[model samples]
Each structure stands twice: as structure tokens, then as C-alpha cells.
Target: MTTATVPAPSTRADAPSASSAYRLSFGHLLRSEWIKLTTLRSTWWSIGLVALVSIGLSLLMATSLASFAGDVPPMPVVEANRQAVQVVVFSTVLTQLLAMILGTITVTGEYSTGMIRSTLTAAPGRVAALFAKAIVLAVTMFVSSVVVFTAAALVSGPILPTGPLDLGYPDSSVLPVLGAALYLALIAVMGVGVGFIIRNGPGALAAGIGLVFVAPILVMFFPRVESFQWIHDAAGYLPSNAGQSLFMGSPMTGITLEPAPALVTVLAWTAVVIAGGIAVLKTRDA
Candidate 1:
């Protein structure tokens, strides 16, 4: 009786792994998000755009610098070179747009494709999913920004030598250059939050562009009126403008918020938008 044959270990098809049958791990969620981000065509476009923008803007500014060289007196070659190169480094508006696109796609694309449903099914923890997305978006944007900025510097370096713009100087404007990249990444995260909250491409795109361009123009235009002048001053403190100060070594004298305060303001905006996204994600059926 004791010798009765023990049934061979039955291998059941579609059997769940012990861990996956129970719960999703944060690490697994992170890997999934990374895969989703890298696999998308939009991600490649966003990254390519960043590099192109950085280089293109630098070249344009370099041309402007060449035109202005006639008006200014000549100085020591290295210092002059540093100043010229700074122009290229400072011209990174395109990089900002790239970050925004990348960020928006982090959530909005999934919603559009219905992958979000699968994502939720895999990891029922809404916060976990959001956290994974934010992390992936931030890291990708940060790396892309750095690469693009470095490429811009290299491309612009040779053109500036005769015009007093030296390339690759260690001491000058490193902080601002690095800050620009970080700021771009932060902006991308802000975009992600906005995209998630809106959950539609056209609406998110419109609102994003409006905030970046239209609002600032309106604020500037109304600065003459007393009630709206406050709007103008406040506009400089908005994420797009204020965060950009990180790229400028000196503060705009009329701007009310200092560098620290401005960055904090941007951070606060990100927190609000992300919180809203989290709320929607938690309550929605997906």
C-alpha cells in the first residue's frame, strides 16, 4: 500500500506562477513601463526631436551671434569664445518641446491604444502603475536632454572659435546647461501628469501648447493694465518661464520669484497635476 505509485508531478498548462498569481511587484511594473516606453514609435520621435532642436536652435543663435560680432569690441579669445558658446547652450527651446511630447505619450498613448487596460490588469495598483510611468518618463527625458545638449555644444564649438565662442570650457555655464536638462525632464513629468488627467490627445496637446505659448503672450500683453500686470509678473513664475531661468545664469530683474522659488513653483504645479491624475486613475474603470 505504501508502495502505491506516486503520480508524476502534473504540469498544468496556464498555471500561474506563485508570485504572479498573488500580486505584482514594483520592479516588475517598472520593467513593464520601460518596455512600453521603448517600444513605441513616439518615443523615438521625441528623442530625435530633442537632438534636432538642440542643434538647430544652437545654429540659429550662432548665426545671430555672428551678425552681432561687428557691434561689440573684441576681447581675449577664450573668454570671447566662452560667451559665444553660451548662446548655443542657452538656445534649447526645442528640447523643451521634445520633453513635453515624451511626457504626454507616457500616459496618453496607452489610453489611446487601450494598453492601459492590460497594464491595469497586470498590476491592479493604480499608484504603482503611475509611479512606474513617472519614473520611466523622467529618466528617459533626462538622458535625452543630456545627450542633445552635449551634441549641440559639439556642433556649435567649431563655428564659434573665430567669433569668440570657445567650446568645452569646464568652468563656464556648466550649472545652467545641466540645469536645463533637469528642467526639461521635470517639464516632461509635468506633461505626463497633464496627459493623464486629460486622457485625450487633442485636448492635452491644445492645453499644453496654450500653457506654453498663448498664456505667456496674453500675460505679457496685459502687463500694462494694473490687474493684469500682476499676471505678467506671475507669468514669469510659471513652469515654462520660471523653470527656464535654470538655463540662464542671471535672473530677470523684474521677475518676482527667485530661482529657488520658481523651481518650487514648478514642482508644486507638477504635484497638483500628478495628484489629479492619480485620483482619476484610482477612481476610473479603465
Candidate 2:
């Protein structure tokens, strides 16, 4: 007896498990961005520059401070020490240039080379790809910053104690290192956001630097000018300057945001750029 054959369910050739496929897409996209970042020769230069800033510049400032100590007015040894050790923390600023460069290239390089089209093609969800780049850039910069900062602290900490300066090792060394790392990471990823939005490497780099360095300078620079002296009050609110207040502990000299408010300010700035970039990225062609 010929039983009527039940129609075999039609299997779509291209269909796969939706959830797993989606996860893999983002995972692959993230790894691709990471590999691209690391593969750049400039990335290594930037990393090396961080290490150099930590090692080279730390020694310079430490020695310079020591030289000035004899000429300066006397103070409590412990107070003097804490102040001396803090100078090493400022090395993080020199590294900010490299961080900005690395981050700018990560996004703008793709655009310059026309690889962004391929990136968009591979991941049709443009926002996912842009966000993935940001995530990778942030993690990379933060981890590297931590390693360099901690190593510099270790090398410089003992040297400080040798002089009249207190090392402030256990607490000061730890907090500043962690804080500096987070700041660098935020700066770098903020750069990525700027790059993705501007899409011009040099223009983005200048904008990022200006925001981190110039805007604050402008905000503060004109404070001496009579009509705009109020602008000085706004300087502490600039992203990098506000971010500096985040862990520098001792109140900064300027009219900067308080630490808690400064943290919020920096985060707000970063969120605005990154979120704005993501919105633009989604709406634009690759």
C-alpha cells in the first residue's frame, strides 16, 4: 500500500540558530577590531611611549623635585613626601597623546583605507560594530595603562622614599594608578567616538586633543581676561581636567568640579560623544 508520503518540512538552506549566530557575529566583530588595533605599528609605538613616559619622565620629575627641595621653604616631612610622590602621577598626561592617537586611528584608519565599508558589510548592524570598536579600544587602553602605571609606581616609589618625599605607597600609589588607568581608557575611547564621528584622522586627532587639552586651556586661559574671567570657572568642568580631579584627591588649584561631580562630568562628556557617534553611525552609510 502506497501510503501518502508526508511532505518533508521545507528546510531553508541559509537559516541557522538565530541566537548563536548573533552572538558569534558580535564576537567576531570585536576580535576583528582588536586585531586591527594591535596590528598597527603605531599601536606599539603608543604603548612604548606610555612605558617611556612612565619610566623616563618619572625619573626627570623626581630628580627635578629633589633639586628644588633644598631651595624651598621647609614643611612637615610627611606632607612634603606626599606632595612629592604625587608628581609621578602626572606622567599619565604625557601618555594621553598616545592614547588619543591610538584611538583615533582605530576608527579613522578604517575609514581612510575604505575598510569601513567592508566592516559595515560584514556586520549590517552598524551600531554594533561601532560599539564593538569602542569596547575593544577601552579595554585595551585601560589594561595597558594599569600595567604601565603600576610598573612606574613600583620603580619610582622607592626612589621617592630615598629622598625626603614619602612614597605614600600603600594608598597613594594604588589609587592614583587605578585612577590614571581609567582616565587613559576613557580618553582613548572618547577619541574613538570623536574619530568615528569626524571620520577624518587628523581632524579627529586635533579635535580630540583640543577637547582634552585645548578646550580646557581655552576655558581656563581666558580667565585673566576681564569680560570672560568667568570662563575660568568652567575650566574644571572640561573632560580631561574634570577627569583629573576624579582621583588626584588633593583639591586642584583651579575652580574645578568636585571629585564626584567631576566623575559625572567626564562620564557625561564621554557618553555624549559615544552615544552621539553611535546614532550617526547607525544613520549613515559606511
Candidate 3:
């Protein structure tokens, strides 16, 4: 019998490995998050809702503005165009709730379904996972919001005069037009951070809504109690108020913050939320 020359397992250099190990990386985490996001029907519904709200309200606003004949004081064409852009951007307020819900669900949904255990098991780095999810959420929301605003601009173009509203893409006013979309993306990431901290859908949703909607109301309401000047000024720095300042328009006499300060405040708020999420993401249970 040919001494079963099953030559000892070849450990020679350049030998083809029998097995391979794959390490999870940021790209893999991001791809996984994207897959999870796209597979959900809510993502499509939210995007559709954003489009419907932005376009519907934008057209309605433009039509209404155009109909204002002799009753209102005549305004300059520049002012009219500014108001139109403001109205178009305002439509995003309603759609932002959808973005927030999407962001919250990105992480909280996994926890609700007990899928987080598998996710953590695969990655073993909660912060990396959360960061990836945040990136996905922010990018999608940004693109969706940009599309919504683009649709709004197209609809508003036909109704408004031939000034800034006519093919406004090349105008200087485009800065705030694009800035509003970027702001929505930031809001979405803020939702992701909150979701990671809460780890529950309903709770995270409520928290997000309260922060953008209710918190400003409460903060503004405080001044009515004692008519405190500082309290009233402080309201301008609230999250929603800051976001509103980001839109291109003349700030209402006293209610809105300066755009520069508001931008800083909004960035600070997002940073705080992300830091909180990072601190607890690794320490908390799935």
C-alpha cells in the first residue's frame, strides 16, 4: 500500500488558505444599514409624503400669493420672490416629522424586533454601527428633502414673476434653498442619535417630535408667564426656531434668531445629541 502519502497538510508558503476570515468594517456597516433602510416600506412612504407635502403646499402657496391682487400692499419683485421661496421651504416643516420617524426607526426598529442582538453580535461595536446608521439616515433625508425642494421650486417657477422665482437655480438665493435641505438632514441625524439613546420606536418618535415641536412652544410660552426679555430671546435659539432661521427670508421683527447664530446653535445641539448617543451606545444593552 503506497504509505498513504497524504502529505501532511501543506503549511507551505503561497498555499491557498482553506478558510478566510472577514472583519466587519465601516463600509460593511454602512452597507448593512443601507440595506436595512431600503428594505422597509416606511422609507418609501416617508419620501412620498415629503414630496406630496412639499409640492402640494408649494403650489398652493404660490397660487395664493399670486391671487393677492389689490388688497395687499404692493411689494418689490425681489421681496415677492423671497416670500415665495420662504413658503416653499416651509412645506418641509410637515415633512420633517417623516424624516424624524425614519431616523428613529433606523435603530429603534431593530431593538423592537430583537434584531439588535444579531447586529451587535455581528459588529460588536455599537458606536460604529450607530455612526453608520446616522450617516445613512442623514444622507437619505438630505437627498429626499433636496428633491422635495426641487419639486417645489419647479412648481413655484411658473406662477411667480420672471425675477428670482424664474429658474432660480442660478441665483444667489440658492444658498438658503440648499441650506434648508441640509438642515433636514441634520435633523434626521439628530433623530438617529436620539433613537440610539432611547432604543424604542414610540419613545424616540415622541422625543423627536417634542424636541422640534413642543420644546419651542414651551420655551416661548415661558415668557408669557412673566414677560421676561431674556426668556423671549432664548426662544429664538430653540431647535425649530434655529432651523427656521436657516430658511432664506427676512426674520420676523423679533421672533427669529440671526441666521449665523441660529446655525451655530443648531450645530451645537446636534453635536450634543451625537455625543450622548456615543456615550451610551456602547454601555447600554441592546
Candidate 4:
């Protein structure tokens, strides 16, 4: 009896799976976004800048705390937590600068290099493509913010030679710490939305940075002007100001708002920007 030799198992090169040839699925989209994010040198640079500024400023604060010790009462552990939250969240300025670059890259870079056409073609639903990128960018920003803030707290702690900075206090810290991270991520998403609307790298960058820095300046400078008070109210609801409220544990010197309301305001801004971007994306050609 002659038995035919069993055929060799098909090699992947010989018979590729359907997955290798399929269009973008949710998972595939996520993976593609991840690739796009990590492949860019700008992303790494932005994240690194955030880490450096946060930790450096934290150490500076710790060093300066000694001067305040004389006139001010010894900071309570809760007060210390508040201070740390301020340092970490305010350092998100660096994160925002970098995130603006990232946002510019994420949307405008695609258009710059003519890759967005391919992206939309693969996904076939502009919203789906946008959603995938949004999910990836948001998660990445949140995680990085958490890591940088935690490191800042740790590094700053040891600078106070007398009393150790204790991050262990769960009561006043945990929520604020989390809020800081969420705020940064939300800012990043909002930046992405700005990019989608502007669709020009320089334009997006300027608009994003201006919305953060210039808008607040204009609002505060002209708050007394009747036409500008409305601008103040609108600017007050911006991501930077609203999100900064998460760190305003101490009594405000100039402006004040409750953290919960601030959070809601920031979320509303995020929603409006994102909706605007979606509308623009639907109408514009790549």
C-alpha cells in the first residue's frame, strides 16, 4: 500500500490569514493609532518635556517651602497634598505645549504627508477613524500625566529635609491626583479637536496655544469691559481655566470656582470642541 506523504503544513508566507488582508477593525485602528503615536519623535519629546518640567518644578517648590515655613504655619499634610496637586497640575503647561504639537501631528501630519486619505480609506468612516485616534491619544495622555505627577511628588518629597513629603495620605490626595491626570488627558483631546478644525499645523498650534494662554490673558485683562465680560465667562469655561480649578485647593487670590463645577465646565468645552471638529472633518477635504 502506497501512502501519499502528508502535505507539509502551509507556511504563513504561502497562505496568509484573512486578518493580514482585512480592512481596519476597532483593534486594528487602535494598533494603527498606537503606531502613528509612537513612531513620531515629537510624541516622545513632548512626553519627556512634561516629565522634566513637572519634576523640576516640584523640586523647586520643595526647596522654596523652607522660606514659607517662617511666616506661614507649618504646612499640614493636607496642605502639602494641595501644594503637590498645584505643582503637578500646573506643570501640565509643559504637557499642553507638547500635546499641542502632538495634536498637530496626529491630524495635520496626516494631511501634511497625505496619509489621512489612506486612513479614511481604510476605516471608511471618518468618525470611526477619529474615534480610534481619540481613544488612543486620550489613554496615552492620561497614563503619562499620572506617571509624571507621581514622579514629581516623589522627587519633590525628599527636598524637604526636615519632614518627609508623604504621598501616603489617601484622604486629600487621591482624588486631586486623579483629577490632575484626567484634566491633562482632556486637554489633549481638546487639542486634537482643535487640530481637526484648523487642519493647518501652524494654525492649529497657534490657536491651541492661544486658547490656552492668550484667551485667559485677554479675558482677565478686559473682564471689566461689557463686551469682554462675556468673553471672560466664555474663557473661564475653557479647558485651561476650568481644569486648573482641580488644583485650586487653597483659597483663591483672584478668581474662584468649585472643583465640581470647574470639571463640568471643562467637560462641556471638550464636548463643544470635539463636536465642532467632527463637523469640520465631515465637511472638509483631506
Candidate 5:
């Protein structure tokens, strides 16, 4: 009886296994984080607000300075260039708040929506996932900041007074603008760390605001009190103050740190915050 021969299933040696097919790489995690960041409606709104604030403020400052250019004596080339750069970056004080909020939401939103579990499950390595998120956030914020600053420079160029205010002079504008973008990127990274630690949208936002905004104001008072002189001295090392020095190319009033020290201060703050977040992420359940 020559019955029908049953054929056995073939397993090719080169075929991918289930585990190998599903394994996620660092690139995959970064791509996934970018996708998530871009897909959110809030991201667009925050970016739009940043642009509006930056450009609008720049125009206002340029117009005002131009009006007074006739009455004022000609300033030194270096001082005028510094002032011009400051005009473009003036809105950073407000725009940073938006950056902080956006950053906080980037991570906390995932937790709020219960998407974090799926993210962790897919990535498996929590630290890598956090790093991916931070990298994405930093890159996005930096690029957006640079674009906004460039647009502001272009829009304000015609309005600014001749000589130092001229955007045509690339000497002072380029590095300061780049530094401003870097500062915003670092601020966003700090927000991500805050979000990871807090894990609640509103809470994280408040924490970010307090750190970047309120804390500076609160510390400002300490310097005025004789007993709190030490705290006042420490205020120059604050992230916001240091960041100001970084973008401004000079220390703000009462801030002692120069550009180099300011950069170090900001980096230290970011590193400490991120390390704390990683510790929390490692110890706690998602």
C-alpha cells in the first residue's frame, strides 16, 4: 500500500528565530522615541509657541533699539555685538519654561497613558530606553531652538540698527546662537530626568517649573538676606543662571560664573539629575 507520503516541515538554518526577530536594538529604541515625540500634538504646539515668543520678542527689541540708535553714542563693536545676540536670546527665559513643560510631558505622558509598560516590555533595558528618550528630546529641542533662532535673526535683521546689530556680521551671532540651542537642549534633558523621577504629568511639570523658574527667584531672595549669603553665592551655580551665562556670553547680574564655568555647571546639573532618574528607574517598577 503506497500511501501518500507525508512531507515534514523544513526549518532553514538561516531563518530568524522569534526572539531574534523581536529583539530591539539601540537604534530601534531611538527611532521609537522619535516617533512618539513627533506624534504628540503638544510637541507642535510647544514648538510653535517657542517660535512665536522668540521671533516676536526679537522684533520688539530690535525695533526699540533701532529707535534709540540715533540718540545713543556708538558703542564698542564687541559690546554692540553682544547686545545684538542678547536681543535674540532674550525670550529664552520664557521659552525655557515651555521647553521644560514639553520635556516633562514627553516622559510623563507615557506613564499617564499607561504606555510605559509596553515601552519597557519592548525595550527591556530601562536605562537604554531612558537614554534613548533623553537623546531624542535633546536633539529635537536643539534643532527646534536653532531653527527658531535663525528665523528670529532673519526677521529682526532688517529692523536692527546697522553695524553691530547687523546679522551680516557672523562673528558674535553664530557661537552664541549655537550655545543658546545647546542650553535649550540641556534644559529639555533635565525635564526628561524630572519626568522620570516624578512620573506624573502635572507633578513633573510643576517640578520642572520650580527648578527652572521659581527656584531662581527664591534663591535671589537669599542673597539679600545677610544670613543666607552662602546660599546666595551658590546661586551662580544654579542651572538657569549658568545657562544664561552660556548663551549670553557673559554672566548675568550677580552671577559670577564665566561662560566656561557656566557650561560646566549646567552639564553637572544635567548629569546629576539624569543619574538620579536612572537610579529611580532601575529601582522602581514602571
Candidate 6:
């Protein structure tokens, strides 16, 4: 059978193996998630709304508060800084809602459109994929929030009663503004976990809304009954309530934790929700 030997099919030394060629790295996964997040129309709309609402609220609050500048004595440096910081971040309430909806859609939209199957097939590691999506969402939300907060600060700076309301003089607003951005980022990440748990956009959104807004309001009334005072106290540990403590100048209607405790509480809630999501992802079909 030496008649015309095929020369062993001439494999090239540099040729990539099938596994290596198809392997998806974490960087690739991140890039893919970034693309998915940026290409969606809803993402743009949410971002636009964030900017619009933040700046609009900043103007409204600044002007309304400035009207009382003459009636009230000049605020102390610390108090004025706090008020300015509060005005700059006043829009966080609505922006957090937008962030939650956007984060939920980031995951649920994939499920609804049947893209998650393809994503899983490519990434293979379900947990890594979920984490990649969350990281991307968190980064996007943080950056967007920073920009919006900065814009709000600048827009409101001149309108605020200038004597004590200095955005840069005491540097008091910096940490709070940064904290607000971080808070929004964490909220978005929590929303990602909710998306994974619910896997339905509307349901996930409703759950997020309840957690962020309705739950706090409902819990506020619990203290009035005296027996449920513990519940009202416990409500301060809720994710949104705890997160708000990071930036808000004053406490909510219920018991409130200190800033450090609030940060820890928010982080704990996010970690628990994300762990639950990972557990569901591993045990369920894509």
C-alpha cells in the first residue's frame, strides 16, 4: 500500500486546537456583555432619563431652596454643604428606579429573546456569564450616575445661595456624590440578581419596585402600631433604605443605621441576592 501515500495530512505546527480556538475568556465575556448593554435602545432611554430627571430636579430644588436664602440666616458651612449635596443627589430616587428597570431588562431581555441560551453555550460557565453581565451593568450605572451627579452639581451650583453653598470649598459634597453613584451601581446589581431569580421582566420590575419604594413606605406605618416597631426598625436594613443612608442628609421615617453599617447592609443584601441567583442558574435549565 505504498502506492501514493497521503503524507500524513500535513498538520501545521501553529494550528489551534478546537478547544483553544473556541474557548471564551472572561475578557471576551465582558466585551460581549458591554456590547449587549450598549446596543439596546432601552439602555439609551434609561440613561437619557437619568440625566434629564437628575438635572431637572437639581434645578427645581436649587431654585426652590434659594428662595428661602434671604428669609433664613446664612447657613453654616457644614449645613450648606450638606444641603447642596442633597440637592445634587435629590434625583437619585427616580434614577434608582430607572437603574433597577434597566438592570432587570439587561438579563430578562436575553431570556425573553432566547439569547441566554446562546450566551451560555458560548460561555459554558453560567456563573461567570451572570457575573459578567452584572459587572457590566454596575460599571455602566456607576459611570452614568457620576456624570449625571456632576452635571447636577454644576447646574445647581450657581443657583444655590452661593455664600455657604460651595460645591468645592469644603469638599464635603465629593464623598456623598461618589457614594450616591456607588449606591446606584449596587442597586443595579441587585436588580440583575432579581432578573435571574424571576426571569420575567415585568415580574422582576415589580419585585424591584416593591423592594425599593413600596416596602419602605409600608414599613413606615408599622411603628405606629407599637407591636410592629421591630419591623419598622428592621426596614432600615432593606437594600434601598440602607443604600439611601449613604447619601441622604437625614434619616428616613424609620430607624436608620449609621453610614458604615448602611454600607455593610447594602453589600450584604446584594451578595445574598446574587448568590440566590447563581444557585437558581446552576440548578435550572437555560
lDDT of 6: 0.86
Q: Which is superior by lDDT, 2 or 6? A: 6
Model 3: lowest-lDDT 10 consecutive positions: 163-172
Per-residue lDDT of model 1, residues 47-136, tens digit only: 886777678888777776667666767676556645654665565554666677678867888899898899898888788888888888
Model 5 lDDT tens row, 106-131: 99999988999999998777999999
- The CA lDDT of each predicted structure is 0.71, 0.74, 0.76, 0.74, 0.85, 0.86
lDDT tens string, model 6, 18-86? 668466789889999999999999999999999999999999999998898788676677777888888
Residue ranges of candidate 1 with Cα displaced over 4 Å: 1-23, 74-86, 89-91, 161-172, 225-227, 249-256
Candidate 4 local lDDT, residue 233:
57
Q: Could you give candidate 3's per-residue lDDT for residues 1-286 as a string of tens digits?
A: 5665444557666556655345577888999999999999988988888888888888787777668644667566656656767867877567668777888887788888999898889888678888888898888888878788877887776775432353444343566777788888888888888888888788999999988877766764454445576776776776667877877543322267766787898788888988988887778777
Q: Which one wins on TM-score? A: 6
- Residue-level lDDT of model 2, residues 1-286, one tens digit each, is 7888755445655556456555557789888888988898888889988888877777776667667656767666555545544665677666777788888888899999999999888888788888899899889888887787667656665555344334455454455556668778888888889988899999999998888876765553454666775666666777777777765653233465665787787788889989878877888777
Which candidate model has the greater TM-score, 4 or 6? 6
**lDDT of candidate 6 at residue 214, scale 0 to 100:** 79
Residue-pair clashes per candidate: 4, 1, 0, 0, 0, 0
* lDDT tens per residue, model 4, 1-286: 8978855567445665666667357988999999999998888988988888888877777778755666665677877766656655666655666766676668888888899999888876688788788889989988998888888877766665335435588646777778778877777787888888998889998988887666666655664666655665566566677767665452212244578888887788788888988998888877
Model 3 regions more than 4 Å off: 1-21, 70-77, 161-172, 220-227, 248-255
Candidate 6 lowest-lDDT run of ten = 162-171
Q: What is the total number of backbone clashes in candidate 6?
A: 0
User: TM-score of predicted model 6?
Assistant: 0.91
